[model samples]
Target: MSDRVRLKGRFIKKKVRDKQVKAVAAMREAHLSKNVPRSPPNLKFSFDGRRIVDMQYLSEHLKCIKCKKDIFLRNTVEESRMGLNCILNISCEECSTLTRVHTGKMHGTGENKNRVDVNTKAVLGAVHSGIGETALNKLLVCLNVPPISANLYKRYEREIGPAIEAAAKDSCREAAKEEKQLVIANVDKLCQEM
Candidate 1:
């Protein structure tokens, strides 16, 4: 009887171990195949809490027109901000598509107030913080940074807003799923107290 019990215990332990190994293997496979959007780490440009964009911000943020892949930094040609009005030429590595993104232009005081050194990410961050476009421009100029035009700010917000919102929603859903068990337990405890 003792021998039989020991044999059964060993068998159960082996089975449990096998299941755990399988689960780990499956997780590794899923991680390898996960196709999350890849953003560059430690990107050089960021919102400084005062200005919306910076010089050379867009040069690091261009995507290939054909493949939609993030273009290599080396492929970006920094042009004359004054002469060309802040247009950057970028070549895509995957598809070799030459594309231009209007980053920002330097403007003389007498020149038309159209371009600022603001990038898309900075605009999005400002909008997310509930700051108005006009106020943001004012803040930038106050900080001695070039002011982004209202039209460009609005365009950036419109283009990138939905994607940001979607990502936020996904993050919230994931957080809620992780807390589901705790939430259920709390609800059950409340009901019992009631």
Candidate 2:
């Protein structure tokens, strides 16, 4: 064969190999995505001595404060300067009741206050404990407060709060594993090409 013809054939072969690698990489990524678990909700909380203080993902059975029907209860955690607080919203499929629970810590003064007030730190703390950073940021934006950074948010996640941190960590680990699998698959394909 002529030199030029040989060179052309070699170039076409390389192009075909490259295309195959890309196709394989794309398929591997898709497979990884399918295997990956959905990211768990970051909202997590536990209860205080007598009250359901932390409201994130809490499941309880109670009489709906509004309709008075026995229903499953769920509370969302919210954040404020003082810490986390829970906002209880009870539902029975047909009706719902909303109530706010405070952790007693107040912002600015850091003093314990009457838990009945909505703006108290205890309430804010309960709210903060329940929601993840993304939700918290959205809530803060809605309330016209500055959004907290993710690093600061992580610190808050590690600090004194609900015992639901385990679920959050498991979620993060699962995501990381999915990402790592993608990386390894791509690397293996590249090595095969060489």
Candidate 3:
């Protein structure tokens, strides 16, 4: 190996040894888990949201936007309870995207300012089924999910709209072609009878 490589290896070895020494000293002074601060109980966030469990469970259902690959939630850096809301910063293993999901509770005010986590599947599914924004919003509100804004809904529609339209058009054309062929076959039999 070159001198630089040898020096780097030696430096890493020294750092590891120093860390081991520090850990031993810290353990002697106090317990490892006991010294760690506990997060407040009132925090609604349980990793993803109020309903979500660990990072593993959340990651299983989420995908990376850029790579279109399964995204894993890395280590939780910080978790804090600001009143009823839980502020969490979780890192992504695949893309290294830092996602912040804050579980917000309804304050004394009438409006909700918390960013609601909407399921992408639900939104896309409803849009595919030709559900309008107003109706969809009402349905979501009834189900206790925050209402999606019209502008945001339109933006989502714009993103996936062309693909959806093409698929629908293809299906319609196939159906029409089949119906025309069936009609022509029946008409030929009638003409032969005449």
- The positional error of residue 121 in candidate 3, measured at the CA in angstroms, is 3.2
Note the residue pairs that clash in candidate 1. Answer: 53-118
lDDT (0 to 1) per candidate: 0.60, 0.48, 0.54
Best by TM-score: 3
What TM-score, computed on C-alpha atoms, does each candidate reach?
0.40, 0.20, 0.41
Ranking by lDDT: 1, 3, 2
The regions of model 1 sitting more than 4 angstroms off are 1-118
lDDT per residue for candidate 1 within 1-194, as digits (tens), equals 22222243454455666777799999998897544433323334332233223456565557777678887646654432321135556666665556676655443233334434345556777877889888886776777666666776776676667888999999999999979967786997878888
Displacement of the residue 80 alpha carbon in candidate 1, Å: 6.2
Model 1 residue 163 CA deviation in Å:
1.6
Error of 2 at 59 (Å): 40
Q: Write the per-residue lDDT of candidate 3 for residues 1-194, one digit (tens) a residue.
A: 42222343564455666777799999976876544444422323334333322344354445544445653334445565432234456544555544554433222223323322343344577786888888887776666545666776665555556777899999999999999999887997878889
- lDDT value, candidate 1, whole model: 0.60
Model 2 lDDT tens row, 119-173: 3332246455775677876776676545556765564444434445666788899
Which is superior by lDDT, 1 or 3? Answer: 1
Each model's Cα RMSD: 26.4, 30.1, 15.1
Ranking by TM-score: 3, 1, 2
Name the better of 1 and 2 by lDDT.
1
